[model samples]
Target: MKKYYWTFIFLYAAFSTNAQVKYADSLLTAGYTQVAAVEYERVLFETQDPEVRNEAILKKAFCYKLLGQYNEAYQNLLRANLFDENDSINDRLRYESVLTAFMASKYNDSYNQYVQFKYYSKDTALVDQAKVIAVLALNEQQKWGLASELVSELNESYSLKLDTAELFAVSKRPKIRNLKKQQLATTFFPGYVLVREGQVTSGLLSFTLKSGIVFSTFYHIIDKLYFTALLSGGMYNVFYAGSTEHAIESIKVNNQKKITRFNEKVSNSLFKALETSNFLLF
Candidate 1:
């Protein structure tokens, strides 16, 4: 009778764990990822089974990843034990760990994880996918030579090589701006720097504002309206000075934006290469 009671408890525990996992999976399928994550956590808390805990951790990490909490996702993947025991789960764990690390912009970590994954996993397809990620990770770190070598080994088309070359060229190109000259231009003419920076509308607006302020102040002074002139003078001092400083800063901002856009283009080119190869992990 005592043996039967122990058996009953074990059966109930197994059933309960299965039910929880199924429910979490359903929530995840329904796109209620946050709730699914919570349910997965509950499973982790109740289960001592290594396999169950690892699966729960993987699912929870996926939920976090979907929510763009990549660092958390990567950390959860780190909690997974029993590497190489189950090939399927191990591959998934390694892939997810690298992916989450990459998404979090921990490129070095992502690259290292990929190296480890590559060493163990026998799945050529998955290794190819990871190689793409590894190339990107190296690219992010400005390791152009390594990225080039890895990408070349991928045996992709010539266009990919061209795109990679373009990325390298763009990175090496000088940023478009002359800060000292822009500041000098702004000091002499409030909006000239902005106009030169191709922010024509903003430049015109700034110039019009300063022009109006100055005209109003001078007109009041000439009309012997001393108190009004004083007020206008105050506005002139504030707007003129502020506009000069702001114009230089605006040109700097625009220059930086152009640089950022260039960088984005480089990243997009790499992503496009991955897409062309059908190895885009996400």
Candidate 2:
């Protein structure tokens, strides 16, 4: 009688687990991913069977991933424990990990993971997809040189849908100027920095415009109270100082901004290309 009771208890547990899983599937079918994820988590915790637990965790991870909760998704993927480093399942998981990091704006992590995925997977199609993502990661970090090198390695037969010529053009380093000298020049002469940087016409134009504004403001005050003149001059001096500091910072950072714009343009193009190729991992 005791042995029969134990058998009945085992049957009840199995049936209960199956019912819970069925409910979770219904939630998923209804597009209630968050609710489904909770249900799956419950299953993952309660199920003693390794295979069922792994499948539950994997489903939960997918639900989180679809919701753009990458950290949670990656954690659950790891919890699935369905793959080893060299297994095909491991390769797919690595791809998902890299993509999740990319979506989270963790470009360096994505790039490093893609490198490993590429090296270990050795699946030509997956490796090619990794290359595209890796290049995009480098572009986001403004590592033009590395991005350009990766682009070169890509097979010409495959189109990334980017203007290859434009990519190369934008990746080339701009002519380096003496940054210190430019900063000093702008600090000393705020309105003339553009002129000194070979934009003499625009620089002088700006300087003239600012001087005109300053002088014009005081022109009417010449005949007014002495206090008014004093106030005007004080305000002019403050504006000049602030403008000088801003000009110095802008000059110093101009080269960096230039590179950033190029990278941004190329990265946008790369994304468009990926869309057409259906390479985005989602």
Candidate 3:
């Protein structure tokens, strides 16, 4: 009777695991992402089958990904214990893991994982995708030379031939090289320089106030050549804020506010750029 009882307990446990998996699948299919993740976690805990547990873990990761909980998704993928080096599922999981890193705005981590994924998988398409992502990651950090080198490598890769439009689209987005030339223009028109460097507000206020006040004082001495050649630069040409140099200089005594605002805009832009297909090539 005791032997029979043990057998019944084993059978019930197996049934429970199977039921849990079924329920998780149903929930996932129904778009109940968070609850599905919980059910998958339960299957991972209850199942003795390694295959079942592995599948459960992957599904849980997918659930997290669907919910936009990228860090959690990445953690779940890390918990996957695949021993087979050539396992096809490993390739998929690795890609997904890299994707989660990208979604989380962990570009450095994503770039590293993408490189490893390319090395391990040797999938030409995946490799090309990884290269573009790496370029974007470096571009985000303002590493222009490295990003440019990667772009050149991408242009040579055959895999990118099929994705020509997207390749060109992403390639053109990095403006670091242009930024260097922009810095030099600061001497000609500091306002334009600031605006071009993502310090739009500061640039506008500073250039407008300074140029306007300068004009008021030297309006009689200032010639068309000086104004047309320097002050009439592209940056000043675009934004014309109504104020005086003295007013702007008074505020500029402490530049922390402008710096903070610029940083915030840059941070927002970084996340916005990541949401594009260019970042999530997978």
How would you encode candidate 2's per-residue C-alpha lDDT over 99-132 as one tens digit per residue? 6677677889889878887777867676676777
Query: Using Cα atoms with residue i matched to residue i, what is each candidate's TM-score against the true structure?
Result: 0.58, 0.57, 0.51
Off by over 4 Å in 1: 1-23, 30-32, 48-50, 66-72, 82-84, 101-124, 134-150, 155-163, 170-189, 204-282
lDDT values, one for every candidate: 0.74, 0.66, 0.59
Worst 10 residues of 2 by lDDT: 1-10
Model 1 residue 66 CA deviation in Å: 4.3
- Residue 181 lDDT in candidate 1: 75
> How many steric overlaps does candidate 3 have?
1
Give the Cα RMSD of candidate 2: 10.8
Query: What C-alpha lDDT, on a 0 to 100 scale, does residue 99 get in candidate 3?
Result: 72
**107 Cα displacement, candidate 3 (Å):** 0.8
Estimate, for each residue in 1-282, the C-alpha lDDT of model 1 and write its tens digit. Answer: 234323432342343347788788778767798998999999989987787787788778877877879999999999888463667667878887888898899999999999898898987677777777787787666566777666676646334544445556645643667777777777668778778777789888888887787788889889998899899888877876776777777766877676556546656776666567546344
Q: Judged by lDDT against the true structure, how good is candidate 2? A: 0.66
